[model samples]
Target chain A: MARDTRERLLDAGLALFAGNGLAGTTVSDLEARAGLRAGSGSFYRHFTSKEALFEAVVRQELDRFRTSIGDTTIGESTVADVKIALALEFHEALTTLGQLGQLEAIIHRDAHAMGDLFDEVEGLYNAALDASAARLNQLMESGQLPRRDPQALAVTIRSTLIGYHLNTQSFRRSARRVPPADLIAILIDLISSK
Target chain B: MARDTRERLLDAGLALFAGNGLAGTTVSDLEARAGLRAGSGSFYRHFTSKEALFEAVVRQELDRFRTSIGDTTIGESTVADVKIALALEFHEALTTLGQLGQLEAIIHRDAHAMGDLFDEVEGLYNAALDASAARLNQLMESGQLPRRDPQALAVTIRSTLIGYHLNTQSFRRSARRVPPADLIAILIDLISSK
Candidate 1:
């Protein structure tokens, strides 16, 4: 029961913080969202302060992201299979990016003051890119992929994914009528050895 | 003169809004930054409220962006020249993106509340993408580039550029050692017909 309440509070924190920001959100607001009385001290039971709750929210989101990435294993044998696997990976990453949108807004807003937390987030992002580069390197070595700079290719692939996400989601732009699946297919065609 | 003061106020608002945000910034902050008396009603003479100042700031930034895009012409005759032109375009766009970083954070944070403003920003972004696609289509028609889905290719190229910019600037990640120039070169290689 205690752990459940903690989880609820964290969930509430993520939503509220992402919506209203750290400075805008109040302790009572968090408690109410978490199913506690409006003026009750229940929030204090789980968090010493709003900042603590914000930190917990960020950490929890990161953990969920890390776990999702870890749970997936890419073991495609053919180039076609690799393309399929990559498309799935793109979808999954886009989903995670969408979920983290709120947290990202908060992070970008408070980045100047929250150096340590920002570093943690950036570190995880870089690590993900590195892992992606390693996978691409393996494919190149196996001759399943063309031998370009694997790291550069990884960055290019990741950038294209992120750009598409931002265009459709954050920017809410039309993307010139290029659907995600179409973009992914064209991307694969462009990068794969012909 | 009065016009100079208005310009100063807009400049100050951009810096302050990007740094402290709309809620965190005050009228006095604007006046102080613009070299007026901190608590004076000088700001009132120029703008009705903080919100008005913010609207002006956003419009001014967008206008500047549109103007920059208008002033550039891509007249490259060779594939290699097109690559160089694209690189310069990417650099310019990245600079604009960097300048608008603070406004972007504010937009993402208040997107739910700022419906009309968000629409206006989204329109500009989509228009920019459309222009890029048209340019790419022209290149393809002239046989300077490969005959692929021009719109999709535009998105792919744009996403790569934006991804690299975000990695280096916003996320502050290492990008797995892929520099912007190298990424652009690889991207051209991937998309161009052999």
Candidate 2:
């Protein structure tokens, strides 16, 4: 029962934060958005403050992201399989959390001020790169890809995807738009080449 | 003389915006930072609000970017010259402006809102891509690069640079950084291949 209330509070906080922004949002906003009355009394019963509640939401999101990292079956999957899987969901995860955009915005804002939060953001990116690199290393070792430094190549591919996500924010005007399959195909070609 | 005041205001706005962010900053901050007390009181004499001032600042920075496009001697320069002279400076101008830790936070905030600001952002990116494409077209016409749509290739290169910028914010743990020269070299090689 206690755990469920905490989860509900987080969901409510995410919605409020999304609508109002971190700095723009207030304790009353969270309390009202949660649809729970009893003033600050009930709210404080569950979480210490709005900032604490916001921090919990970030932790929950990071934990969810960490869980997804475990899903990358690098040893079992082919390069093409991994690439396709990544493209399908990567940008969405970065930009949105269901209906709430607060998660991305909150982290992007405070990551500058808070060292620990910044570390978590960095860790998430590195984990993804490491997973991708592991797959590339396997491909090279198996003679599927040309001999390449999997780490460096992984960085390149990872950077390419990061670039792709950023460009997705501005794809409408660019003359060349590479669809997900084509992007993956290009990567496969680049990796498999000598 | 009037034109020079506008220019000085823009120069001051960029430095202040880069340090304090768009929302956190105020006209007083701008005036104090610019060392123009009465002249700064005179700031509103020209622009109505801080928003208007920001729009002016954004325009000035963007114009500086567009000037680099004008500097590209597309028809006269070789592929190597474009990479060394035009492309590298273009990359620098982008990094110098967008890579500021505070400015990106402001951009990230606005971008999350999914508003008309996106169009303005896209226009600047596309302008850069167009400039690069014109140069690439010249190279292809001269039989230096494979004859393909230079616009398409230019978009790809712009996307690659966008990705690097995103990584600077999104990935904090990858101490394995690639210098802009090596990265630009890799991108040039990718697009110029026959």
Candidate 3:
């Protein structure tokens, strides 16, 4: 029941933090929401503090996310294929993240207050970006991708994917949901045509 | 002097809100930082509540941002030129907002708590996107641009510029700043090359 308790704690903590933010949520509140007895020694047995629990949750979610995307498989077959692969990789990464709303809430909450936390989140994002940039550079060097600033391209592709992700994901309004794959194709076309 | 006092109050509130979130800041904090007497009726005369003052600051900042960008003047001389112009406009808009960290803070804080406020902010962003999309449609119709999904390109361009803006502006410790114009050029090339 220990792992179950920790999982429940993470679930409860994520929901509370997303809804009330870090400063607003308390350890007691988390304990109550987790279906654990109040003043139980079980809470401290798993994690030292709420922040530690938060980091655990974030790491778990990110790990799941990276696994979901799998390793980005690129093809040198055509410029179109390369662009599509990049878009697909970026889209999958964002799609996995957007569904949970965990990282979004954390990034938007206490981002200014929690320096190390934000840096960790930002590092994950930038690392993904750096990978894409390096890939772009390799493609350009091989003459598949045209001569373009790989860093800027990496940033552009990422920003495009994130902006798209933010607009569409988790929106509860009555509207058409553009399929993420469709967006990837559109983005690739835009890149390929240019 | 009254107007000057109100301006000072707005200035102080912006600084406080940016440094500490809305919940963390107090009315007394605003008054003290503004150099006004604590618990003075003057605060009530200018604004109904701290939230109202925050709204005013947000609106003023958005308006100032709009004015700073001026009208989107597009010289329909060439496809590349128009794309560049639109990219420049988007970059400038995001740069102005990101520099002050006003909208970013407001969006992060009270985002879940204040639905109407977040909607207003989202509206401003979407409206800007809609305008850009409309312009792209017009250009495409006149054969100035290409026959692509104006909507997708609009979203893509806007998203890319915003993503770039979020990454660079006000990131305290930085080795090199990618001039926003450079980003715009890179984005425009990506589109134009395709």
Candidate 4:
């Protein structure tokens, strides 16, 4: 029961923190969202403070992301197959990162107060870049991709995906302007073109 | 003097709104930041409410941006010249958008409450995309660039730049991972590759 309550608290923390940010969200807000009586001391029973709860929320989300990425296995034989596989990866990445939008907003708003938590998130971002660079390098070695700086290509691909994600997520109207498939098709054409 | 105060208020609003957000900043905070006596009605004398001041600040920034873009004339004869020109444009864009980082954070945080202001900003964003598409089309027509969906290409280019900017600005450590020139060079190579 304690573990369940702790999970509930973490879930509530993620939602409320994303909505109201660190300074705006109160202890009572978390408790009420968690199905506990508002203004009750149940919050204290689970965590030391709101900041601690925020930390827990971030760490839990990162672990879930790590697990999800670890489970992904990209096995494709041809360049065309790799392109399709990469498109799926891009879609999955968009979904995963979209879920973390609120957390991202909180981090952007409260980076100064977040301290080490911010570093941990940055580490995750860099790891993603490194992973992307490795994948591109493998593709290049197998003659599936054109010869180019894998690191630069990784950054390019990651940036394009992130940019599209931010535009569609942040602006309601931009969703219709450029579809994911169109962007992905162009990206594949650009990098694979001899 | 009143006009000067209004300008100062807008300036202060941009910095304060970026740092503390709209709700977190009080009128007294704006007044103090603008060199007016705190608790005085100086803020009221300039604008009706905080929201109105925010609207003015956004509009003024947009106007400044329009003026700057209008002043730029990219006249490169050769493909290599066009590449250098585009790189310069990217650098200029990074600096401009970086200046708006705080404004963007506030917009992301307070989009629900921003109403029409949000639409106006979205309009400006789409306008940028349109401008980029037009430029790409021109390059393709002139045979300086290969033919593709110009809109998709514009989206790709813009997304990459935005992704890099967000990564570098949001995280202190990401600035060192990939230099702007390296990313730009790879992007140029990708699109121009036959």
What is the TM-score of each predicted model, taking all chains together?
0.86, 0.72, 0.78, 0.86
Q: Candidate 4's C-alpha lDDT?
A: 0.78
Residue B118 of model 3, lDDT score: 62
Model 3 steric clash pairs: A193-B193, A193-B194, A194-B193, A194-B194
lDDT of 2: 0.58
Superior by DockQ: candidate 3 or candidate 4? 4
Interface RMSD of each: 2.3, 3.5, 3.3, 1.9
Best by DockQ: 1
Per-residue lDDT for B120 in model 1? 80
**Per-residue lDDT for B133-170 in model 1, tens only?**
89889878978777888788888888777667765756
Per-model CA lDDT versus the true structure: 0.76, 0.58, 0.66, 0.78
Q: Score the docking of each candidate (DockQ).
A: 0.59, 0.34, 0.39, 0.57
Question: Stretches of candidate 3 above 4 Å error?
Answer: A1-3, A36-80, A99-101, A112-122, A169-179, B1-3, B36-49, B62-80, B99-101, B169-177
Report the candidate with higher TM-score, 2 versus 4.
Answer: 4
- As a TM-score, model 2 comes out at 0.72
Q: Alpha-carbon error at A65 in model 3, in Å?
A: 6.4
lDDT (Cα, tens digit) per residue for candidate 4, span B1-194 = 45688788998998887776677678999999888999998899989999899778777776776676665555332446777777777777777778767666677666776777777777777777788888889989989788999998888888888878777777864443778888888888888876
